[model samples]
Target: MDDASDDLPGVMRVVRGHLTETYADLIDVGDLDRRPPQVRDLSFLSRALAAQAVRILTECSAPEAAAAVTDGEGDHGIDAIAVSPNGSDIWFVQAKWSDRGRAVLGEDGALKLVAGLRRLANRHYDGVNVKINRQLTRIDEALSSPRCTVHLVAALAGGGEVTFQAEQRLTRVGQEFGFDGRTPVKVHTLGLADFHTFARLHAAPGPVQITATLTQGWHTVHTPYLAFAGSVPAGEAAAWFEAHGPHLLAPALRNTRSDRIDQAIVEQLVEEPENFWYYSNGVTLMCDSVQAQFFGRRLQGEPARLELGNARLINGARTLAAVAHAVAQHPATAEQALVPLRVICVDNAPEGFLSQLSAMPQSDSHTDLLDQVAADPQQLRIREEFAAELGKQYVFKRGAPPPAPSAGCTVQEAALALACAHRDVSLSAHTSAGLEHLFRPSPAGAYNRLFGQTPPGRQIWAVVQAHRLVQNALADIARTESPWRREVMDHGDLLISHLAFQSIGLEDIEDWVHSAQQDPDWAKQWTGDIVRSLAAAVTDRYGQSVFLASVFTDASKCRVLAEIVSRASATGNQESTANTVAPARRRRNSISVLVDHGRIPDGTRLIYRPGSPPEEAAIGDWLHENPRRYLATWVNDRQRPLIWEADQQAYSPTGLIMHIWREAGWGEAPVAVQGPARWFLPGEGTLADLAGELVRAAALDGGA
Candidate 1:
């Protein structure tokens, strides 16, 4: 397989670049900072292609796909195994990377994979490696389930299907997995074109091209541009989104938005789909070029075939997302909907015109409330302060990608923290009800009160950090409690945070921040005490039968609870508070054990510093480019803790570290990382250090 003979050189180059960025950790490529994809060995490219196959076919995040790789010693022929989040779907993937852009799975390879599947189905796991062993629990569950569907994926970077004999071998394996006259196993063979398309869409190397039919359409070819105005089937609009996801939007508009707008669009599509065309403002797509194919006269009620190149939906992202959701939930009703659509082909438009077009106000606006505050003098000052004083990224603009939890805070978070830090219980209630209510333009409103005077970035960060600790402590407690108690904890987070913040006197806020950071568990322990005392105060004040969910939102009731809790704290009833709460069951995982024992809580932000000097040099620029990528959300899972914000998916700390390394073009990422050691808890030491401390303490207690 020679690169010179490759039929898809352009596509291959793009896919190879993406594969390298996503799967560099799968191989050891020496101490080079980066290397050309062509120069990489066949094994590295092939393994990356296999991981890409798992990622694309299973729709798992890059880290999850990488974690699925089981291609090493004693792998039998299986390259990777992808199990769905719910364990209801699984894919056993084998792939080949062909430099000449063609790979065909021979009969021997197919048979070997089938044999591996058979061994897995029969629960024979004698010789498998740790990777396969780790996944055995999920694989067994998926195999035993009657409803689960297993897929054998033969993915290649070349242009051809599996050999006929290989296909036959797969069919026989499928029959063996069948039960109750239903075949649970299926086969999927992907070639070069499929990989190319996936790379284009998912990697977002360029603007996505979409072909759609516009009904009852009329086109106008002006001097510089072409425009088409018509009605598009809601189904077609959704299909575009389904195929391309966020790539349908202009580059600048790809950030996550408030769900309120999305919900409104869904409600319309589900309830009054037929009138959607009239009630909703239509979508506008900007294209670099357009090719229109029509059967009859272009203007005389015939559907126009549109092949748009470099297409971007400049407006109506919410509508598109909502329609897609509605179609999935209630397909029959949603497909009946017609949406007004306009496609503008600005083939020779002047520079910055498309940007201007995208920036134009639309009839149906999905603007975030924070966008209004972005230009405010006070907010701008705060943003600058955060960057200058704390060396943190403070994002105030809507549609701007937020900084990572450890790196910075958003205006919304700052406002909420400030509100909770305020002594007024009503401010907490206002914040809990809806963030938008607090953003009202009235100078005398919550917005002014929270940000009227410039607050120090350190103070804001301290409050936000403490609030996060409180949240984690509460979530840990919630997991062990009954449904009602859990709901109260969930719904009353802001109120509880307010109580905790108020309990820490104004003069001691900085001192508490320093102490808590130095001894991370101290914050959790104190929060747990406050929570227990607050629960008691609530029970004593409103009786056990009272609905706490309703009580937390009412300012007057919260004030009373605050009084009771404060009085108990002031009278030194800390021992009684600790005695009131029940003990939690011990968990095995160190992270989970920490949470269960009230040492660390969920929602804690962990800093992911590079483990090695070589690694730091590789990824430092990438992290500097986007600071949010430096932080990962912590969860109390047995194996994985860090949740990646890019896809809102969970990844083991080391897996996430590998992913970051790969993404940063680190050619020589290590096979293993001291995951806990790399994740630091602010002023406290690494998670590895913290866990060791807990272990030593437990040993001391046991000896005692």
Candidate 2:
């Protein structure tokens, strides 16, 4: 259905194929013996209904569930059942397709929808067939609890809108069920326009409008680059992700990011929602246009909103994943977990020609980030002209094949190789915009400084090959019997690959790539030598045990390593220059400040768990002031020991939150902290209750 079906005729073919191949087993498909000749009569309705189910499953991001068509002569008017991704909501679909426009299922169709919903709510398993019966059983089990919501859907093809009379009928039937313990269950209607809208959403999810109550601080930068900066609630961000995740950046990421969403991002969303925003880098997106509305979250349901068209996110994929993960894991926390976001839409400003800039140059701070930005319609045209002349797939996405016969190298690899070797702009601009976090992020126009150069694409491809070959080789080595292998293979493989490229024979990278490209077998022969020589140099300098860890974690080491590989080191720098840097103590020191302040010296030796939160820190400080009271609070409330170790030790706040969040059977996300929050807080909690018990115990002790 998502493939090439541009017109109704094409759609008919796909639809027929779906009915014949995908849902041939459905009872509504009609038996060959009795209705074999008339089977064509049902294909349009059946296929459309099944297609709607497929759309519903996709919109819900539930690829695991199957769609079933069950409409028949004695059938209960239910055409299909689309199982919800999380089983939170199951859609009972009633579809009607008419050959002519304006012809509709009307009130009669609406009543059928209501009847089907009733069948589901009533659990009339015996009335339906084997497949629908099983689905209804699942629905019954889901509805047994008040948590899951039910959706009564009507899909109309060229049908008139559901009339008010039909709506009233649906409302009455819905109220009769009282599924949510309140008003009539809503019947979501999908008209012709809705079908097209959903298709558009799946394609780009843009020309999108994201609205929210602008929490507190937000700013707009208009000079260097135009952008909106603010934090949206995690719940709101989750809504965006739920609506159109991979599609949000489909045009930009291309294929670099994986097909299935990132798992770690999702895990954090489910397990640690409140902290999601803080853990996120926020997202920066590039849309075709942006519209801003200031009057936000007003009375009577009016809210501040942003209306963006052709909106496709350019960056912040990790953040998007985190939001996606959270929605899937703990949807309840989405609103509370606020994620910071920065949006940089397309700068379709009036074209400022290079000559204009040269004459009255407006310096841009984000030149590096926006180097290739189509500053004006003209520049975009010029870029296109150059691309046409080049006769290359000037730009490619993440997942695009990394190699091409005519082009020699993938867009990204070729651009990166040139960026490192020749500092070329034509390709680097496009490459940097796509592979930011991969090759070290840089502002687009920033590389314009390395001008007057363009490396052959073929050479770039060979270098890319060498880079992959070396990284894979290192990974293979890690799997072998070397002692420092773990350190080398685990992290910084790409970083090593980049450094090794410079180390290969003293020839310019372009020359090596050119030779490799021309010979078709050069990299296979020379890359090994480069890798071995580079490894020997690093080992000779840093000792094999400390090789990789010592290089990647420090910048000076990486540069020194690169210098060694290229033999550009004036001394063969046996010394590794060892840019004496201070030890990494940022996190440790910050944590100390949070936990150490207001502490009264205790006679007992302190037990350190290093990364404890402020609340635990406060407790540690408070313990010195009132140890007996604190200890008593825990003892009375928990009916168990407060002290885990012999000495008073601080527990990790997150570790504690995780224990509580899980111990609660993943019931709800831990309430997010707005600002600095204490660990042993007041109000309803085991710890808080323990304090009350402690006070009572103290009073009794005094009375005694």
Candidate 3:
């Protein structure tokens, strides 16, 4: 539905239209056929809504999202389940699509959701129907991981909260699963506004074809392909992005960035249009062919009119998106900007040249490293092995789109898995510091240590899956640990993965798969105890004051920490260490000190990031439904420090945060919060982090 369709009938009409058009083939019809004919469409609509929720929350492609639906009879109230590609997120959706735009999760629905949660949590897949049963193995593995967070998505068609009774039931569920920090179950009530946002994001646009004027144009003739270099008006470039959206980019390059544009690039364009041409890297376009119309003879005198055939912005997609947003927001200022343009005709290009052009711009060390690894004879063999044995796509190219998580993985992902699986904990520790460090060009570097033996494709995939499970399990336990202990658990993800690999003894990589199938809980069962012991052991050895980043980055330090963990686990003395880690000493509040010292620049824009996971879960959906909700500007005043963009009201940071929480319907939110910690300067850390630096600097100077 368009923005103008605000009435109940229009929204419902849109929803109904989608049932037949977008989801007719995808949604399961078996159960709908059994329902009364009058209610069948409504039932389908509800199932469609569940799939939509999966798409929006997990950011999966439509077919994948639709496949997540398990809304037939005996589904236990869960309509769909979607796990993120990285295995960090898991979602369970229960949708209610109402014709009157007044859908509500009533007591019955709430009870059903609760029952489904319990069943899924306790591995009671035997009671679920075949649709859900088919996915029990993957679901079981996801649930067993402590790191993966579960979300209960209540996708209602109405513009209201779930009923009070339903809220109470969900609150009880939250307290049961969420309070423990392990297996945190977040509840999301996605209403009409939220659905509208998701629909907008999910809209698909066709291929883009634009007629552009290129000034001061130059062409190359001796090249294997025809190429033109010129400058295009920023306004024209912006219009292309405005019309085509991500279609402006080549298919493989789309969806690379979360935002429509990079905010920093937008700011630069808007703030310094005259400098844009100098600062920007310009855009590269690949087309089937180009027809240029030039008045008279000289390319320099008159502008050339070009029709770019099947053109795609292969590079600088973010730049074009930034220009579009900037021009929309500040037309007069952004109108002055100019963008350099390069158009290549792929029709006459030599074989393999297109892929070369695509990856040419991304030639950094990591990209180079991946290229080298991909060129290796062993990696080529592994790719074939994966195809022959596992029927998976093994992507190794730098700019190539990654396959779906279930389909396969990229070379970079494989390296990380190998790092974690190495018997030497230092490899995993080095990875925690930076992935490139593993690929450093040395004979004895982590690269040779991991891939030197040319492990089989099955082994690589198995280790990756195991590493994901270990990472998730550690995250779940870390949330409930003491502040110091939690830090170790959070940073020691790869280290724990290494420990699990050593202990599980993957003599055969398929052993992990066999064991996992036999006991899905093996990951959590084995890793949870190890992580707890490791967290305590690290703190005991290094003390709480030790810089965690430094410690994790150093191989020797991580080796010592790993030994301590292994020793503690073997001795059954995990809890023997005295809890000497103290809470951080109180200092002047960062915001107050920053304001009193006149440290922050006035008028600087601030972004509101949720201070905690719970806080994010509480209001993230609400904030996402409207962009203005999370935007604010900093001011000099200590008392009322922020000007919230939504209402243009000046409020103290905490007051603004509370106001947003209340407005978002988080009625049970705590009364007090450290709000400065939630707001951040663009490209800088949180306000608290910024202020803490100043305080630390002053202290180092003896309070001078």
Candidate 4:
């Protein structure tokens, strides 16, 4: 056995030399197969071939020897460990030889291999742990100090369910018991097809010819000539090469056969005569003087135009080559900013190729607006003022009147006086200045009497009067020949047309009254002609059209329309005040609904209602009317009390009973519920029912 192994290297060298001489362009001669013993048996022959081929290409070395090992169960199993040349690393290789006389491994086999390795790594044997423990300890120490790597090699002989099974098992092991410190343990696999390629390139001619006999009664060797390339008769070899050579060679030359090939050819032409006459098929095509001059001009940074005839083989390649050559020869200058240029050709390119070209790096040289602004101080100040209110601060001397006395004494004094005046009469220095620009002053005493410090009742009444005045002014503006007036007129026409079709008269006095009550401006714009239209619609439909009148009368329904018209009117100084109303009373005696989707912890109080307002009585009445569908509280083993309150009072009740529910296995998982049912308040069910039902619904919807 030692003598045979010693001659293996010499045999491989001879085989590699023959292959290199025969297929110089195709094969890398430096790479040659080195067979592993565990895979030497006829049953594991393909594995041996694949292991050797991969080892050669990757410059990897096989282990010194292989042996069989068992867990003291009397099981005869081979443990082929391939150690790296450095002896510091090792790969536990396992081959699952098929019993069905097929070349490929099986899924069960792969799973068994993964399981066996995992057991080996963890098990302790023979008064001391096996090398696996020592390996793992070294790995752990290496990880703490630096990085460590481990490899798992799964060698498969043929194709079958084994391939898929092996991949899945490897993935599972990697995920579950990650490498040394949970670091990745690399896994490499060699399949049957790869093995055949290796065997054809490295096996001795005589032995290779006997491959079919060796694999007999096992895998059915199809086309042995094609399998080992030259192991069969000459006639068979010719036929196999003619049929399958292209298929085998395509992937290897895919990168070279790219669309840029034409471009590469053209670029080569731009070089000297010595470079242009390069050989591919041992045929050198010389460039004529004209072609040479054209390429010369292109190389010299001068634009050269070529008009190759309609032969696509020559023209397409020439165009692409020319473009690529030009780009390569003449690069962009720093001062002359580079802009990406993409040429989209619908010719024969794949989809999105043009888009990919367009995405290449390019320069966008444009002046920055902020940088320009930074060059000027006056512009910066103006920008700052536009961003915030303009104001100045100044210190007043003890004996002197405030600085800028005319502007207003001190800033604080001026601010305080303005605030006080605004509170007392709803007007401040700002308001006074704004008003002065719009209105002439009345006699001083007359103005003082109307807006001076006065009783609270009088002040309130005056403010209401002023508000009404502002509303009336805005109403006048709505009646003017302005853009807003025209828009209202248009919408009004649309409204009248709609009502007329429904036999509702816009001219009806009741309709006018309703419009006036809701919006004074619309009422003012309802002319006699519009009114007549309304009247006709009303008479035609009788009292059935009364609903149309009510639609226009409702204030809430017209709030949005009112706001639009108010904002459009030039004199609408009180537009902001038009919709302002007293805040609603905080409702008490209210039912809190809490639905914890397990995102919140148990006993987490998400909703708290401190006190109940008078409005809550209404809510309570509503809840009382619907009891069967609603549950107030629910508790489970995983969740705390759903609802609780402090104390109760009439006007300001404290501590109202809160409705709560705990729906286990709710939302995401590890479910718990605590809080009111605020999330499900709109539903008909009570807090407890909502929580339980929602969880059940989710689970059922998921087909749980």
Candidate 5:
């Protein structure tokens, strides 16, 4: 088959942007610095493929902060690996960057990837480097579980087909590891053509297989498009959006808008879902083709359902989100909430009109918008006023594309920072939460108090960058054989860093940020200060590997870590004392323990304590019975125990009484029973005690 040269420019554009955004710094491009600087051009085959693999890891899979660049020597023929959100699915990507642009993976090339997968699945990781071996260890662990599904992928920059023979070879490799056809490893062969299709789908996901009730019997109506008008249950609408996340808004790296509208839409869905058909502007679905099957009319006095295949949603992301929200709130009621939809099947490509559809306004939302708290004139004034103070743009709606990276500080960043820093946590939320506003409709004070009385956005962009620097630093630290490797949370740690960046013992941190923004010299010194602080933190607690463990496990400790870092920065120690995460502890006890009191700094209390009732056997039974009772209440009453805050992307300690008290809002904690009084005093125990406390907390959350 002949490869078309025409697709190169567009495909490469997505590829290029993907490369730049995927990495926070040149360090992420690990071996590139070791090579001749020009080799870092990244247009080179191996590097390009590695970058693309990174894109697949983050974009196709969960946006793991761990998605890394591995184009260096000793990579073991593996470009990247993405652990699925649940840790059950793993994608081992082997990419070939062809100067001639061929996308085909011959059996020989596929064998290289297959060989590595075989080694990893078989737990033969000694052949790989330390880093790759660590990931392989995790892969091997997941493979032992019945739920694990590994994907063998061959990505190409040019056009070449993955022949049937290559796929058969991949199967044989999986079979060697006991993966039969029933639980066979999934295989994907992608070239530039597929990348283009993927890009388009990402821009607007389609052929989503939606089911709805036809407003009228469908006859092929074909002038503008082969079309059908219908009604869909809000639950089904929610399903579609959840299934096609980010694809529905492809090309946008993250949903970085600052508008509180999804809640209102959901309110309408719950309160007057019957009027949803009337008040709704209806969803527009684009598909390459569609087929509908009648599921019979309902005797429940509503429209009958028609199952439609290959429906891609183009114009109703907000509605989809709202439906998802409504369904989340009232599942039974959401089953009853029907929404209007228009399904259009087009043989022609859809890129041309999708953006136009996205721009088109749905009128009913306007009525709700009028009633929104953010829409109140005073809140509008505050938004405008805050925007003016920051000398930035004031965005007015949800789903508005984020301002360009160089377009100064964004409201979303400001709001997210406020939410993490302020008392009003529920004010601003991730787009997935669908309520996005902390700066407007609430207190101008959240913004005002960012610097403890001034809008932090003035210097926030720098702080955000500093936050990223700290995260990248932590990631670098975690790569070592430290016990805290699995404990790093990028964004949550960033919030803690931000909290530290605020003024504390030193001059107000915001003033420093503002000053740093104005002066490059100050900025450099400030960055060095933060780096040193994190370094010292990494090395703290007598070189204990769990030094910054609390930063990830406890939100309160996250705040404490911030203060620790800030104080270090204030000390003006230009050199970092904590260079690497400390080695694992030498355990002296089977039970939990913490660092010695003499070694532990002031304001730092022992977090891990193991002395409980001596009846260990009965305690096990007690834990087994109604195990999730505590998990349910502390994590969630209805939803699965959210051991991690999805929006915050941070871990929580399930067994910790204070964390449970705060997360579950279960009144005040029984301080005497679960307080500092029970801590393992200085020299009372070895660091072994802290280990089980952290491990148990993590296990509790994981089980929950």
Candidate 6:
């Protein structure tokens, strides 16, 4: 005997042939063989089972001719194109085939198929733009049109995995590519089982045999018999009837005494036997009895009372208590009960029970009776009253009697009264709002309003001082013909010279003079003092604003201050000072300072001055104490003093500043003091250490 797996193809072939023949009226010519083998099989089966779909489209609405299969490339991966009979719209079909057994398609495989379709679609469109035209032009242009509808059909030899991911991917792809516009692309999988049912419905013998081997040993066999009066074959009809026909007659047949319904109900009850009784009694009464009698210990009259085999009333109380306890422990089960309650109360009796219970008075005479009993002179007074009402012979009954309410007794009324009390005890809206008001901040709106405006005067003053320094620096550069000055001036020249000089005939020389005067020594000095004052104030106020200290105490800030001081010192002798020449002794001393301090590496010499040590310690100290001033003074002096000698070459003040600043902090000690001289050449410690100690002292003194 051939294996069942081997027989699948034969069975599929028969199903395919039967479907093609049965759906010939609906199938487009030449489409039967055009599809892939698996797809063809699916189309065959889908047509057979989708007879209602065909009737909905064709017979009812008079659909246009069947869509034509087209070999085209488009953004939506449409393999075939079709138009409604009236030319109202167009439809595109993407057919996929797989040999995997009848399992839902996996996410990865579905994604891959979607990707393939996307690639085909991308090739058809020139760009992002989509065009619509009815004319049958080149395949790409036809496919690229926006009016087309794309449908995805997965034809699996058996059902491939139809996962949630696959479904979502199909939906998303259809939306992105405008498959069916607002309607969405229709995605479905067709399997062999479907084909067998379809074949049976449309073209099979009167009786069909379905055989499978059970793992336990015996072979299970099913032979469905059917009577068909239509063009569909008996076998096909039998298969269809087996799968779908039962549902149509199920309701009527289920009402009768049928073994199928009985067996189904038995199986269902076995799975959830509690549901049998739960639904039998009205669900609301069952629920309330559980809450009141079982869990709550406040019994209300039973909504459902059934006669037991022993002729006693089996109230919902015990069951309700048990179910209520179970539900309380497992909240998930509690929520699931709401649906069943709505279903079981189909006649509206539960609603009536709720209404009746809700209408009861909150308090009655029983409350007054209880109060009276509580106020009795003797403890046994209430007991005596109760004993007088009962007969002596009935005192010790086999089963305990149900507890009775005092005086104007009504359990439902009491429960309703308790519920009302609970409602009244809940928090009031005013109390909740008041609690929120307590923790809020004072003047909350003030801070937000302040934040929306400009900063206060002190901050603006600091910014203006910084702007002045930048202006001075630019002005100084404009006055000098040095390469550094030239570079700095070029940017301004480009902007100003373009319109002011060339077109407006403004004199560049006059412009430079006016700009230079605005950046006078007085203005620069004022700005520097203002900035220093602001920085000091901030440091005192905030205490630990290190970022502010770094910016304000920088060498550039010091240099600006130093320039103003130097200019002040040189005022009266302005012309004479400018022409004054430093003696050979001073020059020689300066060179010696550079060498001895190791500003020039060992054995390095300067040609300008080759003798005497230049009060190296004093010069270095002054440089450290007022770096910006020293830099401004050095630049203003015409004597070009070589600062460092490396490779027999002299470095300028600007070059030295760049190198020193790269290694140290703003407003820090001179390079000569902090460099390798003191520590490397037999001193107790380095100049760097001294500088650090001095800075620390200044900081402690609140001077920095």
Q: Which candidate has the top score in TM-score?
A: 3
Candidate 3: give the clashing pairs.
146-473, 147-472, 147-473
TM-score of every candidate: 0.36, 0.33, 0.43, 0.22, 0.35, 0.21
Q: Please give the lDDT score at residue 150 for candidate 1.
A: 73
lDDT of residue 538 for candidate 4: 32
lDDT of 5 by residue, 396-445 (tens): 34555666545543445544544443322222212112223233221211
lDDT of 4 by residue, 471-549 (tens): 3433454455444233233223323222211221111212323334466544333332233333333333322212121
Q: Can you write out model 2's per-residue Cα lDDT over 220-323, one digit (the tens) per residue?
A: 67766566777777777767767765566534253333323444456655666677666556766555566666575433223345566655666666567656
Q: Who is ahead in lDDT, 4 or 6?
A: 6
lDDT per residue, candidate 3, 1-704, as tens digits? 13223454765656556545677788777756667865776777788888888766665677887899989778999989887654545788899887778888888898898889778765567768988988887887666453445677899888856889998888777445423322246788888776665555457544467777776545545376788777788999988887766556775564342232345567777777887777676888888877879867754436788898888878777677778888999988545988878888888777678777765542223666777777777678778878986898888777889999889988788888877776567677667756875664332246654554355676677777767666766666666667766666766777877777766544333455455445545545566667677767766776554435445655777788878877775676753221111122323456678887887789989999986666788789999999999899989886588999999999877678868977998743532345777898988888878888888888889956
Against the true structure, candidate 5 has what lDDT? Answer: 0.47
Ranking by TM-score: 3, 1, 5, 2, 4, 6
What candidate 4 gets wrong by more than 4 Å, as runs, is 1-58, 62-78, 83-90, 98-101, 119-146, 160-166, 178-183, 202-704
Angstrom error of the Cα, residue 183, model 1: value is 25
Better of 3 and 5 by TM-score: 3
* Whole-model lDDT per candidate: 0.71, 0.45, 0.70, 0.30, 0.47, 0.31
Q: Backbone collision count in every prediction?
A: 2, 25, 3, 29, 16, 29
Question: What is candidate 1's local distance difference test score?
Answer: 0.71
**Model 2 lDDT vs. the true structure?**
0.45
Better of 2 and 3 by lDDT: 3
Q: Give the residue spans of candidate 2 off by over 4 A.
A: 1-33, 36-39, 53-66, 179-184, 196-339, 342-704
Give me the runs in candidate 5 sitting further than 4 Å from their true place.
1-90, 94-210, 214-231, 234-283, 287-310, 315-340, 345-380, 383-497, 501-531, 535-704
